[model samples]
Target: MQNDDKYLKSKNENPGSGMPIDEMHELDRTLGFKERRYIEELRILTKSTAIDCIIDDRFERIIYVVRQGDMGIAIGKGGDNIKKMSRVLGKRIEMVEFDEDREVFIANMFKPAEVASVSFGERDEPVMVTVPERGDFGLAIGKGGSTIEKARILVRRFYGKEVGDILIPNRGNL
Candidate 1:
């Protein structure tokens, strides 16, 4: 729940890339070193309210901590930061913000793709996200199932929730 505890928990849950980042030896760890430096670099370049940078099998998505009313500064002026990061990292870059509320957090994860609703199932089960339209389906799920994996990992890390699936209604049927 505390800031330090959050990163520690995040490192544990997101083992694919989190590594061991503790208050004592963050810079000593290779993964921690790289991530911290990258985050700083992003901050200097974008001057945004970034929380952290998550590197996953799919691509990198920078997480920011924007205030509730303000739109995210995650994407810099005219998306310049995103473009530069994409060129520098050689991977598609996505952005999301951290929220105290899990439902809002889930909505942030699937940004640009409007979420109609979000509800949790049984404990230790998946969380469901409803999108407004079918066209947003692919973007919510990501190419090759990567985005959903990112969502699941982050959910587990941040909220201790494991997402089994992000279901989209069949607009064709309607």
Candidate 2:
């Protein structure tokens, strides 16, 4: 039987302009409910501090933006606070250090992947990341490929650095 309903668009179809309010609310309820909950949890966890927590619906992730003075306290000794928060929230939590200088902050995020060097080019630059001999390429990329992708976006957005490619160095060859 042929489906004649014009409103029944495929999942890939983008709801264009002039969309109904109910539709927008439905979309948020469907896709953003969990994310909103996560953001609320972060706010509750850091309510004592002046940190700003933002939930990115597009990325479905939470960012904890903290001032310099509160950074250490937000991430308690041995990361105990973060570990507890992660357990209680049941979502992957990431901390983004807010700096008046965005460039430095982006550079700091890129440090965790063991990137040996970063250089800027006119169009797109390559990032060389060093890994131990037994390092798994999958681990470097991270679960569901979210870690590296987030890092790349953070670098580009904060520093205007175009990372077209990522190179993982072979430790055995070092």
Candidate 3:
């Protein structure tokens, strides 16, 4: 987004600190030329609204990070962009505005699903996230783990936090 933190720009060396050099290299390799092309096409599709996009192959999803207030622009007047892009890319497309705060960023990625909390653990271990109810948890995880896969990837890429799993609270104990 236009108001997003400057660190998220591609010119920056890293989105955040403490990224393993190996993971960075692997990300570039994973993206390669083909994947990068998809992102490029999307950038053109969204015009100047989107800063970048993520092609999460593991989950078959494409996430576009639009400028702070341009989600509508990326989505088009009536979701034409989503329909056309999905048809072209053959993957689910989601548009989310950019944010720098760790918690806000994670919550935005899991839109329509409420996040109870996000806890950071050991340096090498994945972080933990708490959600409520089976239905909301399903939303957080997506139809076949599509959304959560993006959550993990973006969390790592944006905040350098590795997310392990999503947890649900015990309502019976309350």
Each candidate's root-mean-square deviation in Å?
7.2, 13.1, 4.8
- lDDT of candidate 3 at residue 4, scale 0 to 100: 42
Most accurate candidate by TM-score: 3
Give one digit per residue, the lDDT tens place, for model 1 in 18-135: 3333422223222366567666666666665445556664454544333333344557679877788777766667666766566787787776678787886655466788877777
Instruction: Give, for candidate 2, the lowest lDDT window spanning 10 residues.
Output: 1-10
- Candidate 3 global Cα RMSD: 4.8
**Residue 132, candidate 1: how far off, in angstroms?**
2.8
Per-residue lDDT tens digits of candidate 2, residues 126-156? 4434444234344546667665666566554
* Better-scoring candidate (lDDT), 1 or 3: 3
lDDT of each: 0.59, 0.49, 0.67
- Model 3 Cα lDDT, one tens digit per residue, 12-74: 344433344445433331345665676667667766455566776676777777666667767
Relative to the unseen true structure, what is the C-alpha lDDT of residue 87 in candidate 3, on a scale of 0 to 100? 92
Better of 1 and 2 by TM-score: 1
**Candidate 2 vs 3: which has more lDDT:** 3
TM-score of 1: 0.68
Residue range with the least summed lDDT across 10 consecutive positions in model 1: 21-30
The order by descending TM-score is 3, 1, 2
